[model samples]
Target: MDQEASYGFAPTEFEERVARAQRLMGQHRLDGLLLTSMDNIRYFIGVDSTFWESYTRPWFVLIPATGAPLAIIPEIGRAIIEKTWVKEIRSWPSPRPEDEGTSLVVEAISGLPRRHGRVGAELG
Candidate 1:
């Protein structure tokens, strides 16, 4: 696939939407959000090209109020995740852990400035 054109599909209005979502998040009193579902993450970040390869790695994205969002993905996605919007990507090599790498997700959520932390999670 031509990343050039396909990726540009949603990047145009992504920033504005992100701002809008952030505002909505604030109004809803959410400290931040953890995105684990592919659809939801794509909706928020405007990039929808994560598919599992030989490995069954889970994909998750975290959007915080103050800083850039983070991407927690399977090792197979390392290249694109790094090359893509989320420069900060936490990876899990296969042989999938029984815990399913929730620890990293939790840690990322923990790092959020949750003083008034009403966190939003996409549990799909």
Candidate 2:
């Protein structure tokens, strides 16, 4: 590994984890997976940036029922999150419980036309 690549994750690792998750989704009849935890998102998207600063901030990932993962990050963290090959991205600002980035997620799901799909969330 080169010095610049020392802290970064690889794309192959990302793809493998996503394939595994998709398989799990199929097995569980889950529409998709929501990742609010750091490691889980990294495993799926290969973004290994610092995330401890996000507790007061809203941070999560929405893996759509039909496409790649989309990250819901703070406005300031968008640039770093975008470095991942996972192109889908949405941002939310702090000091607002409204979570505007949520709408982007909603639109994606609404466009799915999956009227009766089960949303298996791991938020508990």
Candidate 3:
């Protein structure tokens, strides 16, 4: 591979993953999937970041049942995520624990065509 090639999974790989996830969501009657962890976020968007190590910051990738994945992340990650196949990116100022993107996330979820009124999430 040439040095110019980007890192992480290929664009097509991410597309397929999102497609499969959407299919599963359809079967499960979920309106969307809210991915918060680094692994799950990276899996869909192919964005790897060391900043995820900071316990203070949280990143998200919301995969809707009918469209491309939307990345709700800190503004610092905008540059990195822009390099990926994800087109819809929403970012908030970092270290704002008072809000910490909670509103943005809720707004994104609220706009989805929620037939089942369900959104899948990765919970420990």
Candidate 4:
């Protein structure tokens, strides 16, 4: 069993949260949501980790208008993140001050459907 499975939210609970977010996204006509904060990511995907303490790596959770949430994270956290409900995970090497998953994030956002898709990000 995965360590996260024991402590994280149940699969159904995660699904409910995702459904609620998707509903709101649809109401607002958003193509997707970009969640960079640890709290927001955990809320959406149930990925609780102390590893977020280090600023060396940035983690992202992209909640599309439909379907499951996608996690864009560092390779170091892959094992732990895999334990969460998020199934579509994209990983990159950490501490890469130059890039730091910037391109990966851009690509992920660009892949969303709709030529003029609107993606919402949590700035605060």
Name the best candidate (by lDDT). 3
The positional error of residue 55 in candidate 1, measured at the CA in angstroms, is 10
Candidate 2 deviant stretches above 4 angstroms: 1-7, 113-116
lDDT of 4 at 94: 87
Ranked candidates, highest lDDT first: 3, 4, 1, 2
Candidate 2, 1-124: lDDT as tens digits: 6523542556676666777886777787777777877777666666677753557675677775556877777787788777776777777665466764567667755555353486556665
Error of 1 at 29 (Å): 0.9
Top-down TM-score ranking: 3, 4, 1, 2
Q: Candidate 1's residue-wise lDDT over 77-120, tens digit each?
A: 76766545566888887657685567888888888887576788
> CA lDDT of 34 in candidate 4?
93
User: Candidate 3, residues 1-124: lDDT per residue as tens digits?
Assistant: 7422553677678888999999999999999999999888877777788977787778888999998889888898889888888889999999898987889999999999979999999988
Question: Model 2 scores what on Cα lDDT?
Answer: 0.68
Candidate 4: regions farther than 4 A off: 1-4
- Candidate maximizing TM-score: 3
Model 4 lDDT tens row, 31-118:
8999988888877777778877787788988989887888899888899888888888898888789987888899998888863379
Candidate 2 lDDT at 32 equals 76
TM-score of each: 0.78, 0.76, 0.92, 0.90
* Cα lDDT, model 2, residue 6: 44
Flag the better candidate by lDDT, 2 or 3. Answer: 3
Name the runs in model 3 displaced over 4 angstroms: 1-4
C-alpha lDDT of residue 121 in model 3:
95
